[model samples]
Target: MPTDTQILAAIDAAFGDSPRPEHFTHYRHCCECAEHDELLRHRDRETLQHADVGNAGWDPICFCSPEGIAYYFPALARFALAEPVPELDWYGWQMVFHLDYGGAENPFFQHCAPQQRQAVAGLLAHLLETRTGLLEMDADSALRAHGVWAG
Candidate 1:
C-alpha cells in the first residue's frame, strides 16, 4: 500500500503546495486514505461541534461552509461544477476543492486522485444537514441552484 507520505507527495507533485492535501486523499483504495478519511471526519465534527458554521473555518480543521465556498469558488469549478453530474455524491463536492486550483478550463479533471474523491464525501457529510435551500439535491447530480446563499 502507498504510504501517506507517498500519496501526499503524489498530490503535491500533481496539485502543488498551497492547500496541502493534508486532510484529503486522491487515492480511494488506499488504506491510508480510508484511515485519513475517518480521521478527517472526526476532526470535522470536533472542530464544528457538529453545528453549522455560517461563516466559520480555518482552524486546525478546515471545513466548507457558505463562507468557505466563496474562497474556493471559480478556481476549480470545472471538475466540481460540471453539468450532468450523476449524483450530488462525494466526488461531486470533493472536486470543489483540493484540485488543480485555477478555473473551469485549466484543471485536468481526469487527474483527480482517489483521496480527493473521499474529501468531498467528508465535506458533504459535515455541511449537508446544516445548509439548506441553496443546494437542491435530487437523487442524482441533478443539482439545481434554487436561491442565493441564505444568511
Candidate 2:
C-alpha cells in the first residue's frame, strides 16, 4: 500500500501542468450561489489550496468547472485523507469513487487527462489498501466497473 505522501506525490505529478481556466464557472449555468462565487474569488492554485471545503455549506464538487474540479481535487483529497471531516470524506468519496450516485460521468475521470486518470486510479488503490471498511460497495466490483484498477 502506498503512503499518503506517495499518493499525493502522484497526484501532483499528474496534475501539475493542468491549465488554469481564464474564467472559472460551475459545471452548469446555475443561479449565483455561495460556492460558485467563492470559487471564482480564488484565481491561483495556491489560493484555492487554502479553500475550506466546508464553508459553502455543501461540497461544491459537481458544480465546479472541469479546470476548477481538477484544481481543487488535490486539496480535497488531502483533507479527506489527513483530516477527520466526514463531509469531506463523503463528498470526496462521492466525487472520485462513486459512479452510480451522482452525475452520469465521473467528473474527475471525464475532466482529467489519461495520466491524471491513472493517478486517480492510484489514489483509489491506496484507499482500498489502507482504509478497508470505508467504501460502501463491493470494492473490487467498483474498481473494475470504473476500470480504475490497472492491475
Candidate 3:
C-alpha cells in the first residue's frame, strides 16, 4: 500500500514540469477520494466474503480497486462538492446506489431536482477526466525520468 505522502510525491513528480494550480487541487482531491474508495472497498469485500460464508447479516462495505483509487475517488469528490445533476446512464445509476448509497442512505438522491442530477453527472465526468489525465501525465513523466521515453 502506498502512503499518502508517497502518492502525493508521485503525483508531484508526475506533474512537476506542467504543474498547474488545477493539478495540485485535483491531486489533493484525488488522494482524499482514493482513501474514501479504499475504505468502502475494504468494507464491501469483507461483507461479501462473510456473506459467502453464510453471514447474511454482515454489513456491506465498499472496496477500492487500484483503478478505483486512480479514478473514481477524485471524480466523486468533485461531484459531491459541485452537486451537479447529470443524465443517468446504466452505470451512473448503479454508481448512485452502489457507491453513493452503499453504507449510508443519501437523502440527496430523493430530494435532488433534475438540475442537481445534471450537476452530479458533470462532476462525475470531471473526476473521470482528472483521473485519466493524471495517469497519462504520470506515465509520461515516469518514462522520461527513467530514460525509457522511446519505448
Candidate 4:
C-alpha cells in the first residue's frame, strides 16, 4: 500500500489547486482520506474506530458519517476491493457523486463541473487499483516498505 504521505499527496493531486473551501474542510475530516488530519494522528491504528456514523443499514467503521461519505467516497471508490465496487451499497456514495457532478446540497457542487467530477472519479479509480496492487503483495514486505510496521 502507499504510505500515508503518498496517499495524502495523491488526494491533493487529484483535487488539484482549485478545491473549494467546503470540500477541503470536509476532506480534512473524512476518515477514508489519508489527508484527513485526524487520520494522520492515529496512524498506528489498523482501522477507524467509528467509521459508520452515517450508514443506513450496516454500521461503518471509519468516517461513516454523512459528511464523511460525501467527502471520502471518491477516494474510497478507488480502493474498493469487491467487484462492482462496495460503495454501491452506501447511500453516501450516491449523494457524493450527485453533489460532485452537479447536485446542489453541497456548496462544493458550485465549484465542480461534470468534467471535474469525472476526473475525480477516474483518479479515485486509479488510487483503488494502486491500493489493490499493494494489497496483493506480501504484508510484511509491503508494510516494511512503507515503514508502517515494525513487527
Candidate 5:
C-alpha cells in the first residue's frame, strides 16, 4: 500500500498542483485538506448529485447518505452515551463532515435552521471556492482573520 504522503502527492498531481508542504495535519487523516479538493473534484458527479440542495428531507439525524448515515448514528449514540455536545473546532467539524457524519447529530448541522439551508449552501460554495484546506491557510481563515463570518 502507498504511504499517506504518497497518496497526498498523487492527489495533488492529479489537481495539477504541487504538494503543499505546509499542510501538516493535527490528525493523520485530515479532513478537507487540499488533497481532498482534488479527490472531490474527481467525484463531482456523486457530490453534486447527493448534495442537500432542496433541504426538504433534512432529518434531525440527517442520515441521508448511507455513507453519512453510518457515521451519523454512531456519533450520535456516542454523544448520547457521554452526554452533552462536544465543542469541536472548524477542523473537527470538517473531519466529521468529510467522514460522512451528518444530520442534527452534528453540532454544526444543528446550528443551521431549516430555513437557513440556502445560507449554509452559500457558505459551502464559498468555502470550496476559497479552499479552506482544512486549516488556517485557506479562504475561511482569510475571512475569519478579516472578521467576516457569514457568506
Candidate 6:
C-alpha cells in the first residue's frame, strides 16, 4: 500500500490543474440549501483547500458538475483520509464509484480524464487497504457489487 503522502501526491498530480467552477452545485434546487450556500462562499476563491467541505456535506459533491467535482476532489480526499467514520460514509466516496446508470454515476468519475480515473483508483485502493473499518466495507464484495474495482 502506498503511504498517505504518496496517495495525496498522486491526487495532486492528477487533479491539481483542474479549474474551479463558478458554482459548485449543478441544480438550482440545491442553490437554496445551506450546503450549497457554504460551497458558494468559496466560489470566488482560487483554491478550495481552506473550504470546509465536510461542513458542506456530501450532497454538493453528489450533485455538482464535472468541473465542480474535480475542483473539490482533493479537499474531499483529504477529508476521507482524516478520521473517517462509517456514518459519514467516507464523505460519499462510494457514490463516485457506484455504477448504477439510474442516476448514480458521479460526474467526475464518469467524465474524468483517464489520468484522473487512475488517481481515483489509487486513492480507493489505498483506502480499502488501510481503512476498511472506516469504509465499513468488504473489499471484494464492494468491487463486485458496485463495480468499483481499482485493479
Worst 10 residues of 6 by lDDT: 95-104
**Taking the tens digit of each residue's C-alpha lDDT, what string does model 1 give over 54-132?**
1123221133322223223222332222233333333333432322233223232223344443333333332343232
The lowest-lDDT stretch of 10 consecutive residues in candidate 2 is: 95-104
Predicted candidate 3 versus true structure: per-residue lDDT over 1-75, tens digit per residue: 343344334433332332111121122346654544344444321132212111112211133332332233333
RMSD to native for every prediction?
15.6, 4.0, 18.5, 13.8, 18.6, 4.4
In model 3, state the lDDT of residue 57: 26
TM-score preference between candidates 3 and 4, better one: 4
Candidate 4 structure, TM-score to reference: 0.29
Candidate 2 lDDT for residue 4:
94
Q: lDDT per residue, candidate 6, 11-53, as tens digits? A: 8888888887666664456444546646655553245532344
RMSD of 2: 4.0
- Residue pairs clashing in model 5 are 62-103
Instruction: Using TM-score as the measure, name the better of candidate 1 and candidate 3.
Output: 1
Which portions of model 3 miss their true places by more than 4 Å? Answer: 1-99, 102-105, 133-151
lDDT of each: 0.31, 0.58, 0.31, 0.37, 0.31, 0.59
Structural similarity to truth (TM-score) of each candidate: 0.24, 0.70, 0.23, 0.29, 0.21, 0.70
Please provide the root mean square deviation of candidate 3 (C-alpha atoms, Å). 18.5
Q: Which candidate ranks first by lDDT, i.e. highest?
A: 6
**Tens digit of per-residue lDDT, candidate 5, span 1-151:** 3333343333233222212222222223434333433333333222432221112233222323322222232232222122223343233233224322323354434443343333333333433443345433344433332222132
